[model samples]
Target: MMFLVITVISTFVLSNESSRIPFLNGDNFSDWKDKILLTLGCMYLDLALYVDEPPEPTVKSSIAEKSSYDKWKRSNRLSLMLIKSHISQSIRGSIPPSDKIKNYMRTIEEQFVSSNKALASTLMNKLSGMKHNNSKSVREHIIEMRDIAARLKSLGIEIF
Candidate 1:
């Protein structure tokens, strides 16, 4: 439902939306996913937390029960809109157009996010070998480390 609102509002505001709206580019899927999550947080959406799909109503279901089904469908539409609006054209072109948010999110995750095991191993190596060289100030080193930590945290891989 929120995505519906975002999309409607965006229609007016978006011309070269992808260019003007700052988001994760296709160059680094992991980075893009992390930034998008934070952006969602500001809007009170938690993509990280699991949300089970609403159960489909049966033929004998009451009117109110059927209404819940409609809401579920609407919610997924909103989710897809959010995902579509933020990605680069290069990435967007590859996405199979779908109404189900789960499918849209899953497809992107599988293709771009890569295997978490590999990402975690790579990040762990970076963390283990972290060093502060004399060429840069201590502040720069700390800031760089923070960036790494944030990335790790965003990907659900804890390095601490």
Candidate 2:
């Protein structure tokens, strides 16, 4: 039917938008998390991130309660799928599984904290050792340096 075709097309377009987020390999969790949050926010799919899951609806439940539960369930399911999809298989294997988006995200944050320190030190060393070389244009060299600094900033190092 026309409705089913329209639904499938819309879903495809929306999913393509999420492909802008990079895979969460071990070294890129902070950047990946930032992109994930931004993408979810832009799509209005971040309800599960900010809210607890709603209680299940019963026959006696009010319409408002049923609606809230439905909305939360959809948000939770989709957000989990999006987050899991962007993580690399190697890193994904280490994560403790959880159906609850909030709990899963908390675990992910914890998993990355130690690695972030390692990443920060690696970036710091690179920044310290970088010198102006004639090999690349000044613009390119500076742009590369700035990109490193931005990545460092995302990891909580303020290099400005």
**What lDDT score is found at residue 55 in candidate 1?**
74
lDDT of 2 by residue, 42-154 (tens): 76678999998889999999999999999888889989999999998988899999998999999999988998999899999999999987999999999999999998988
Q: Where is model 1 more than 4 Å wrong at Cα? A: 1-62, 115-131
- Measured over all alpha carbons after superposition, the RMSD of each candidate to the real structure, in angstroms, is 6.3, 2.7
**Residue by residue across 1-160, what tens digits does model 1's lDDT show?**
9999987765543343323445546435666666555544444343322455657899999988787667666556655666688877877887788667767777888776565556667777897798987889999988888887776776777656
Error at 9, model 1, angstroms: 12
**Error of model 2, residue 71, in angstroms:** 1.0
Model 2 misplaced regions, further than 4 Å: 1-13, 132-141
| Top TM-score hit | 2
Candidate 1: Cα lDDT at 35: 58
